[model samples]
Target: MTPRIVYLATADARGHLMRAQLLVHALRQAGAQVDVITTSDAGQRFLAGFGIEASILSHHYAMQFDTRQNMLRGASNRNVLHYMVHPARMLRDLLRLRRTLRGKDILVNDSFHPAALFMGILPVARRKVVHVYGGSLREAVLGNFDGTKRRLFSHLFRHVVGWQIDAARARLEHDFSYAISDHAKGRDCSLPTPVQVAGPPPADGLNSAAIYLNPHFSDTNLAHALCEGIADAGLAAYCVGEGYAGNDGWVGVDPNWASRAAHAEVIVSAPGMAALSIAVVYGRPIILVLTEQPEQASNAKRATALGIAHQTVTWRGEAHDFRCQVRQAASTLRRMVPAPTAVSSGRLQAQARVDAWTVRLLALCGVQT
Candidate 1:
């Protein structure tokens, strides 16, 4: 029987949607029927960019972030609380989800979603759910409460999240390393971070730098600073991200961005798992533009420690300072020599990993490959 799968991807960052895109494409190619549900309209548009159709759940929740990319804890809490108490929207969306999942063989929850989490608590719905997430994402959720004044609330919420994870039929944790054996002993199987395979590098040679920022960095001044910085290094910038859509000079919503970045002299992006995975596979040196995002900050540290040719530039509200930092990072990374084996070896390993994951997923859904 063909496995019928419903993937629920939250759109807090593009990484979740990107992961969903790869997995959904793989599943469909393998003759599985896959339907996608996202938390917001932005996610719908993002999936659409790759020619994938996704429906938006009416009762969606989102984290609040400022134009500078700092998480607004107070605002986020209030928003979530409001959503939780709204009986009408919550009941309606839950019904929508129940209807969607009726004939599906499995429900894959990428990262987290409140509605899915709630459904996982039900005995009937819990059996069909398989939660997918990365190590950084797990850390980010726990790290958010670290050192906060609300210690009791933080502890309780952590336990709540733990319970939700325990409720899933299975958990698939993915990372950006070759060591999948270490995590194969339990329900939590660590797979390689799934990313789209890159085509051959540009025949014309590396011509420009690729910059990708997520929608959180909506400050126009930051975009201007980034453009100036890349120009200062005498490299043309091929910028991607909804945040840069308003900037007339940058390319926005390019579905072929990974290919473009594969040909870049260097990749400049926020250290989201999707972007980082692409950089590693393509063997491109990267400059991680950091903000107050805890997950991204932790990811940047890990990437640097792992010996990736990586640099970091934290925003401090000064356009001039940020511009200078980007210029310096870009200039330095452009001169670094990328390993010859990095591209070919990484690409092959990544493909193998994704294939392994696809097979496992199919088996979990009772589909004979």
Candidate 2:
């Protein structure tokens, strides 16, 4: 039986999508039949760029926001009503998803909790849940339902939750469950325990600086502003991402961003595991712009604690001030003379473990190629 694996990744962040993309590629390279599902539109394109087509789920989870553009609430009944009005499409989408997951050999959950909920309700054959843990499981599970949902679903909801919990326990014990960072186990936060894996290496880059920002920051124009400031300082700055496009022809979100990152003297970006992993490759100085999201904030804390990067609370400041920070960072990079570098043995071991897992999954599918 050729292994039919389904990768369900929350497309809420770029890091999640990119990480899933890499995993999907490795699986395909190993000759496994892989299907992908995500909740983000950009994520669909991101996966497509790598030749892996994905199914976009019309996520019914409502997000509460204010004038300042913060996620005041996540997945509430207050927002579900709007989508529920379209009963026909909602039912169709649910059925479509059910059909997709009913008989997969392996199901990989990259911090996508909705899959767990579906697993609870839908009868999935060979229901092997391989969780790629990233965010707080507590928040993901607890945040999905408010008081109204609990009272509405009644005891049936509790039973479903129990199944989800059992699935999580099974996933944790399973070898396929992976935690992206080597230090994830030590964090006393919302992260989970699993095989600690390192990030993929970027292409060999120059001695200049590069900035990779999440689309979330596009709301405030901070990502773009930082790029402009860096360029204004007469430094080599490659900004990889949209919203910051054109950038007065300074840079565009390039597909070969890793290659650009490989040459940079330092990196300025959000604390995504994938981006952080690239920075870790050559011990590049990272100016981490912290986000309120637990997973990213946790990554930033761990990176700073390990002496991997400097933390900035926000990307707010005048253009001149931002330029001064860039100049200072470059100066510090130069003063240091010889570049310092180190890679965790755990990270290296993690990389190897993932490769082995890929081979094992392929074998399970009875594919000898």
Candidate 3:
């Protein structure tokens, strides 16, 4: 029996969408049918690029931060203000969800969708909605906070934010919760869901066939810098992004970007939780995380601090410095043993956990894996 899975992912942050994508692939591999619903055009393109048709419902975005010179200054409280100012969006969102999702087969939430929050209250259960996290709120503050920011983060603010996380965890409590990595689980100590560390998913036979290397980017600015470096070096890397054009490298969208990332020789990326999780699953690829935002710098710092498989870089630094780091990363990667054996042991363990979820999800739908 093919289990029908409906994944509801919010696009405030793309990591959630990436996780939902992993779930979709895993479910389909197990012979399940899956559909995705999202609130961003970027999400739709991501799904379409990978051959996953997502229904787009452009809702008001949450967490619009004030960014300047490629740095996050602060987050806007517009979501709250909007609700207080006008209930139109909320009412519309509620009506659409209640109508379309009421009878759908098990819903999985990667973001804090109101549907997930209200599920347990209205004769429904948040446990019915699998909550996914690549990075938790606790990390957002603790990881990136400077001394002033830390001191300025009032007791009231801390209390309110902690309550929000706790409330979400309580609502979405389930026998198991999905964490992008063990590090995410470690940071989110309050998560009621016993965290299962899902390393980057296995290549699953999706080999990158002479397709040249794939360079991933969430930092479009850094992407341009890195691509410029590639061009200066006269290297031919595959640039992967919706609106990204390659310079000297070829620009093409591969549906299996994750798979390619897993098998690449060296990956130029950011240390965002999604990238870290992907690195864990991909194994052996030397990663040079392009640090731009505070959160990214923090993630990069932590990746290096924990001695996890990554190197950090500030792409905004001197372009020559950036190019030097790229060369250094590439050079270091060229030295590792051809095949991943010692590292494979850990990744295989993580893959087992992912497979365990696949089996459990199948069983949840009354199908035997």
Candidate 4:
């Protein structure tokens, strides 16, 4: 019998949902019945194209500002109250999910929903797997610090931020956790979940198609810069998905990533974990822009550091330099190299790692994979 799996995710942003969708596809291909539980209709709609089943939960989101310097601001803080606001309803949904999977074998969490945190405390034992997709909170927290911000962060989180990560790792000890990058490891040296080195999508599939560019969320200023570069080059650029409005491009709302990506000459956008996955999966070269999010900045730096693509900072004052880099990257990509055997080998290694994880998760739930 196929294992029944529940994927927990958020709908406010498509990045996590997109990764979950890809994992769902992999699970189904491996003969598992997967149901994604998230908090938005938009997520459901996006997942529908992948033929994945979905359930909705209540959620709240805070607006993000333009710079990393702004993260120390009050608005950037997580509102613990928001999590408690719908406690009763979230509990109800958790029970509903249990009922939906009466004979199911596992609960896979990617969404960081409160229900995952409350697991094992419930009256009944649940075979659960918590897959934390982002980098280590330790890394993220440390990234937030960089000398000058360290004092500010210590004052804000009461030095409890790092402790929270330790606690989270402890709670998830009996569960399976997967990080998207190796940089996320080493911080939690004793991570309960088996760590794997699954890099984002490779950069080579770009071609003659007119690239439609969109970042992870709304990096409006970066979007404007990219659009300016594309338009000034006399290239027809297409914009879609979230945060594409008011920018110059063809109105292809609701990102059909699989299809739209095939027509992209180069994807010029911010380096989101999921967005990077799509770019690599489609073999698309990306002109990655750095963002204020600690994780995103890390990803941008890593990708650039690895020479996978070109990168630029949003706040950089040189528009001429920015345009020059864009055009040069585009021109170079016009004659980009072929996929090395190493790429397929790397992808196979990733699949193998994920397969091992699936088995571990199933076995933890008392099911044989």
Candidate 5:
């Protein structure tokens, strides 16, 4: 009998779905039957494109803020609560999942702990793998908050979110937890074990479609301001992972990168791991911007450290500032001397290890590794 794997990933952001899609492809190649669960319309569209069958985990959330954003006590706090009132529904759904996932061979939760924990409660023989991407395990290592504020937030986290994550991990018997960033491992104060770092996919394929990784909501003024900036910057911008819809210069998000990279001069968005990877692969200059989320801020910082692109404040609205930054980045490209067009040694080593680990995982799961 073929081993079956159920993968759960929240559609809170496109990154979650994107990573899960990759996992599905790899799992299928390894000869495992895969079922993916996602929560957003964007996730559904992406799954359709991959021809993967996916189930939508529906919930009513007002504003989707992750762990870092939960620290701020006022507006951000209000935003979190206003959006997090699905406690009863969440418990109910978890119970339902527990009943439904009674005998899967494996359950993979890619940054979707709630569903993972629920499935763990079932009397199933499946192994649980909690796959964490860049933002999943950030608190312990990147404690950039002030000392007093850190302590206070730590207390809340330990008592509240920390306990929840702990319970989820404990219940699920999470055998192997994977982290996307080697830079993020052993950093989170909450977990005892360092997550096995699985570096992202290599930047090799050239995407033809001009792509935009928009994590921001489409309606917000800030999102609008930034989208407009991107439109004005040059290439078309995608909003909410859809093709350019606005009358402004921005082209909505299109996954079909069929020809965008070849035609467009640049790809502008927050410095996300996936976007950065795409930029690197396509050799496109990125306009890194800080977004409302702290994790985004951190990612942007890392991208700048990696010499990836131009970084700017979250609320960069001045047209002149945008123009100057773009011009400067373009100038830098012009003056750039040609280095050996080879993959960096560090990246090559990382890729080799990750490939080995993927094989190991497939073998352990009896998937013909």
Candidate 6:
């Protein structure tokens, strides 16, 4: 029998949407009927850009970020608390979710969603959930309490999250490398990050740098600095992200940004797992624009440690200072020896991981692959 799958994707970042897009495509191609529900209208539009239709669940939570893309912890905490405790919103969403899950074979939760996590506590829902997330998420949650102040809180939080993770029937924790093993279960396995395969490069040769910033980044001066830096490094720039549309000299929110990144000489973007995965699969050296976001910072650090040729730049309150840093990083990365076999090898590895994951997912849904 063909399995019916309900995928709940959070909209806090584009990574979740992209992951949903890729996995849903793969599952559909494998003959599973997949229905996607995202957290916000923005997410619905994003998926639409890729020719995927998704419904928006009105009860959604978002993290608070400053104009410069710094995560505002206190404000974010308050927001989550409100979303969790609001009686009307919570009750409405839970009822909607229960209805949605009815007759569905499995629920695939991409990253975390408070409502879905709550629903999974019920015996019926608990047996039908498959959670997908990156290792950086685990680090980010625990890393929040890293230094001298809250050791006990950190310890208790770790236990709580661990138990929460086990609420699902199966979990797929993905990362660039498989280094950590917690011995959860055979069903809970770690695998390489999954990314969409790039299409053939355009007829014109690949010589431009592709830049992507999430909707959270809205600083105009930083965009200008990036344009100047790319020009100074003597490379053409294709910039895409929210708030960049119609900007002078910016390509602005191109749906084909991934293809551009695939063929580009280098990639410039925040260190989101989706972007990082694209860079790795295409063997494109990247310049990571980092902020105080723990997940991104941890991803950048891990990318460097994994010997991926990359550079990091941060906003230091002045566009001039940032321009110089970007220019230097771009120039340095552009001159590095290109990995001739990296593209084929990387693509093969990603394809294998995705294929393995899809098979397991189908099996869990009681569909023979």
Q: After superposition, how far is residue 357 of candidate 6 from its true place, in Å?
A: 2.6
- What residue runs in model 5 are displaced by over 4 Å at the alpha carbon? 61-88, 113-129, 135-137, 140-153, 159-211, 215-253, 258-265, 280-284, 309-314, 334-368
Give one digit per residue, the lDDT tens place, for model 3 in 1-369. 458777788765555566566567778988888778997776777667656789865456454532212433344344644642466765566556556655555666666554454442444443344444435434553333344555565555555444444443222322112343332222123222221233353444432211222223333555556655544543445555533445334344555555555555455555555556555544644455443355556566656665665555555556677766665655555455435553355456446655655665565566865
Error of 6 at 295 (Å): 1.1
Q: Write the per-residue lDDT of candidate 1 for residues 1-369, one digit (tens) a residue.
A: 889999999888888998888888888999999999998988898999888999988634899999978889779878777777788766777788889999888889888777777787788989888888888887787656768898998898888877888787888888765454633535667777887766666665445898888888889888888878988988887778787785766655877777777667889888888788878777888889887777778788889789988888877889999999989988999897777676677667667766777887897798656
RMSD of 3: 6.5
**How close is each model in CA RMSD to the real structure?**
2.0, 6.2, 6.5, 6.7, 7.2, 2.7
Model 2 lDDT vs. the true structure?
0.55
Clashing pairs in 1: none
Best by TM-score: 1
Clashes of each: 0, 4, 1, 3, 20, 0
Output the worst ten-in-a-row residue range by lDDT, candidate 4.
169-178
TM-score of 3: 0.69
Q: After superposition, how far is residue 39 of candidate 1 from its true place, in Å?
A: 1.6
TM-score of each: 0.93, 0.71, 0.69, 0.67, 0.66, 0.92
How does each model score on lDDT?
0.81, 0.55, 0.51, 0.51, 0.48, 0.80
Model 6 clash pairs are: none
Error of 3 at 244 (Å): 1.7
lDDT of 6 at 4: 93
lDDT of 6: 0.80
